[model samples]
Target: MTATAAFEAWAAQHHIDAPHIAIKQTQHAGTGLFAKQAIVTHTEPLLRIPNDMLITTKNATHLHLTEEFRNTIYQLFDGTDEMHLEGKNERLFLKLFLVHERFVHANDSFWKPYMDVLPSLAFFQENHVLFKNYAEHLAGTTLSVSISAKQRALQNELATLQEKACGWLDQITLEQWFWADATFWSRVVSLDEENEAVDNGQATHLALVPFFDFANHSLTPNVRWQRDSQDNSFLLMPFEDATIGAHDELFISYGAKSNQELLFLHGFTLSNNPEPLRLRLPVTPFLAGPSQPAISRFLQQNAMEPFVAFGYSHDSAPSSSSQVLPDFPIAHQLFASTGFTYPSIVLMYLLALDEDDGLRIDEQENIVLGNKQVDAMDGVAEYTSQLEHFKVIQLRVILLLLDALTYHHGELSQSIPETTHPSALTNHIAAYRLEEKHSFECAIDALALLREELLQEPVVIQYMSSQEQQ
Candidate 1:
């Protein structure tokens, strides 16, 4: 099928209910899931991982077929089964969960190169049992057919994808790398019956969804939640007083991200020689439905509260058995300085149907919509005021980020003497006349994007070298 026809057919088949895929000519970002009438933060469910498809393992490896692994895959599919010969089974097993273009057009190894840079994946393979990236995301990872099998007519294009997927697994397996606390660890589960675990000790495969793929990482953002003792169905709406632009990306502290993963992706170099300074905060905002008194009193006292999420252990000990999302007091201290915070939740939604779709929210309750429960899709009326509250909190966070800067000139500047070299820091004197300029610029950019107002903002340079100005 032609690309347009294919995309439309796939959309229709998968349940893309929009009138058509809206393409933006200017923005580098590919197709975006558009908003019909200012979609506000109702915390409506979007995409999700199926529990049954989850193959939670202690570690993922790619060593050449070990005797134990071979036995397992053989027993699972009996290994020699001709079904592995490729055909619909291969596509259904692996590619079905990936975006149609990459799945059909790329090799399995094709994804490995892409996966190669993922700190979380690297950390998991090398360090932990398993890690995930983007519980919901686009074609971040791909699954290809084992090329030795039957050749599809689209081999040159899609076959390459298949090849890449395999190559990716091989290298990671060979190196035994792993990533701990980044979004790379958590994957949205795709339900494909044909894709079963091969006895050969390969990392269990996962699926990725497109729209829910917009999540970006941050040390902080507005919004918070925790499971209430009485209310199992955690409805995460924005704070009543928060402000949001028409098109801002609503991110709150739903989950804790790994510092190792953060270091890898954002280029933050953690000091092995010196530990992060410990911080203490007297007050923290309790989540909406506080089961514990500790979090409750903190929230009650703090005017603006920002909660925390626990990243995985760097030591690689057996992951904390208790699944309870814990708070990081240090993170809260940073936010308490700003006056915006409330209790919130890190919710996990799922795909209930086989088709692609979104839901409409009538009441403040969960109803099955589309293939998953998209949090942003529930009409804005229910949470507009709260979202605005979130926006105000976000502004305060941005200001805090600005306060962390060292500006010397009208331009922006950032120089971490430890992570950066003397030369790099020296070079920036021309750009920033005042110490605060650099931090303010970064915070501005960071906050603008979070508020979904990236379009109107001027280009704020967080780190500009002296030579670049010439």
Candidate 2:
């Protein structure tokens, strides 16, 4: 039987069925489910897979492997407090289980049909960032940076897993592990918390659901999946408002994910993906600013825990922060007013404020200026008499954004490969970068408007005139 036919037969044997949907090959996404006939929104589920059939870390342990091998797998899977750390241990266990089933057990394995249909190791080597071949195409993009880090992480973890191995795991090659990593990352879904009772002692948070994994992703998905707690199965059904027509491809939203995430994890990029542009401010050291010592101290004090005005130290800080930027009501106001990322807005404050700026970190670690500790909930004057002071902050922010966005756009432009016959991967990299470029342009345009508004302020005009005379 063909791979698809065998896969369907396997699903049927496990009691998975979707009469209204059939698997079909497509120009993109390889194989996806399509509507066999017009299907309306209904109370009945389109497809269901019993909880027992889910290929989870909980279920894989029962496989007929050597006692030593099974013990090793158990130790590795249960040893980490970091199991929740991006599901690393869980995925590693699943990857090893998959390799063992496909190679060691081969045709005798219960999951042989599913294994036959899993994408080959060669497919991931050519397409995924986990492999070195695809990294060059992603150079100068955030995903490229992530690709480097992810490869390092995988190698480190793979080494650790191998160190803990016995028997069959010794036979698994690095190439097989990489392929299994790709398979798990692309296909695994987090089981719903509501279905916790139905896990049947598997107690695993992640699962690779049979047949349900075939539906491709869409931003405006026609279908949604949920754990049918009462039925002890995972259900795929049309959304209440959706009207799926005959022959139309079925789609389920992967989640509201960014292009970088989609490309890194799933090996595909969407055109005009609506995920917000992630703008991370590059950390520049505060070497000689008038408030450098004070700012540096504040950053150091709260470096371990996030809070407004603290947490981002001078030497090295992440491109983003979860803290609220304290006082300077104008700075706080600009954050909501300008939809800029919180870290960027906070960085603008650091650049604009000085020792003489009257902003001080009080004994309580609350940022206060002139005896007023402003917060998101507190009331303060609508406008300050220090208009010239606030104008400086706004102008500095405008210049910083313009320069950063322009430089980033230039880097992206230069890194794009100059080829007329671009492959799908190249196109995906180009489109992903294109969305970031567009976001940069949009921010630049908004900065211009902000600059124009700043010029209109009387205090700003007087300040500029005074500086010009100097």
Candidate 3:
């Protein structure tokens, strides 16, 4: 029997219900669930898998994980925040469990039918952004930068696993570990009560629900998945009044994700995706500048509220002597999709300011303060508010941003080859990069209009006249 047939038969034997849906390989996309019969909306669920059958951390422990192995895995979670413990490496136990089932477990293993159907390591290396071969398609794009970071993190995770789980029974090759991770990220879903219940009673918030994960992602999904606690299963529910035709492919929204996120996580990119591209700009020059500390201190004191509102606030601010800039608390990286991403624009604005423009760091108090001690300098806010200074700072900020965008966009443009026929991976990367460049172009046009308006301001004209007279 084929893999899908075996899985379907396995599901049927296990009481998983899906009377009207069947899995099939698509013409363009990979394997997906298709309707075997016309189904009306608000009717019976298309598919349901009992929660007990889910491949959760708790479930994995019960499979073949020894008491000793489970204890070591639990120790890995030591000192980690009970509430916020989710990342590439945090679920090493689950990945290790999957590896055991895939390699060590025989036909008698309960999870054999499902684990046998998962895509191979070669498939992931060819498709996933985490691998060097596939990541080459995203060269010169911000997604490539993200891919590199994730690759490094994955390697770090491999080292940690090798160090912590020192044994022969469960110690798998890095390739095997990577496959488990790829499968988990691409398939797992968090239970609804995850955030609230993870600390107290919940053993795990995430689960790989078989069959249900076969449905592909769509921005305009006809069906949605929900945890049916009453039924003790996860249910795929159709939207009200949304009729699905016979043989139609089922789709579910992966949430409002950007091209970078979709490419990184799901190994796919949607052309003209409704979400804006997340552009990660190079801030090395700004970070290394002599005024970097002052700029960070200024934003920390005067702009912490706005920074916090933008979700960029760090748990602990970096020391002034630290070379890292504080505004980009995560990685000292700047991510912007539009001129209106206030945090990016505000950081650029501060970087563009100087002592002449009323930016001063008071050593005595170790805080940023406007130079009211200097000639006619009211404060940093007041100095920038003046028409002449306002226009200059605005112009400088625009140019600084435009320069970064142009550099990245040029790299993307150059890396994309000219060919009449291209592979699917090439086409997808080209489309994604073009869309990102479009955002940069839009921002440039908006800044141009703003520049013209600023030049025409009465205060700007008056300041120019005074400068010419002097």
For all predictions, the C-alpha RMSD in Å is 23.8, 7.3, 8.3
Which candidate comes out best when scored by lDDT? Answer: 2
What would the per-residue lDDT of candidate 1 be over residues 315-354, giving only the tens digit for each residue? Answer: 2111122112233233222222221221221111111111
Task: Kindly indicate the candidate among 2 and 3 with the higher TM-score.
Answer: 3
Pairs of colliding residues, candidate 2: 308-324
Error at 235, model 3, angstroms: 1.1
Give the per-residue lDDT of model 3 (tens digit) for 1-470.
98889999999998899998999997655688999988865757888888778766545533555555555556666644323445433355567666766765536567788887777787777677777765656777777876777677777777876676556444567677778778777776667543121211233466678898788888778888777769668888888867799999988877767666677776778864655554556555664456566555554565442221111111111111211123332221222322345455555665677766666656543424363432221243344555345666766676776676677668877887564556665666677777666655665555565556657877667767876999
Candidate 3, residue 62: how far the Cα is off, in Å: 5.0
| Candidate 2, backbone clash total | 1
* TM-score ranking, best first: 3, 2, 1
Give the least accurate 10-residue stretch of model 2, judged by summed lDDT: 308-317
- What TM value does model 1 have? 0.26
**Each model's TM-score?**
0.26, 0.76, 0.79
Evaluate model 2: give its lDDT. 0.64
lDDT per residue as tens, model 2, 311-398: 2111111222222232334445543323364544655555555445556666655555555653422211222224346776667667
Off by over 4 Å in 3: 58-71, 78-90, 103-109, 168-171, 193-204, 294-338, 364-367, 371-388, 418-421, 458-470
Q: Indicate whether candidate 2 or candidate 3 has the larger lDDT.
A: 2
Look at candidate 2 and tell me the lDDT of residue 354. Answer: 46
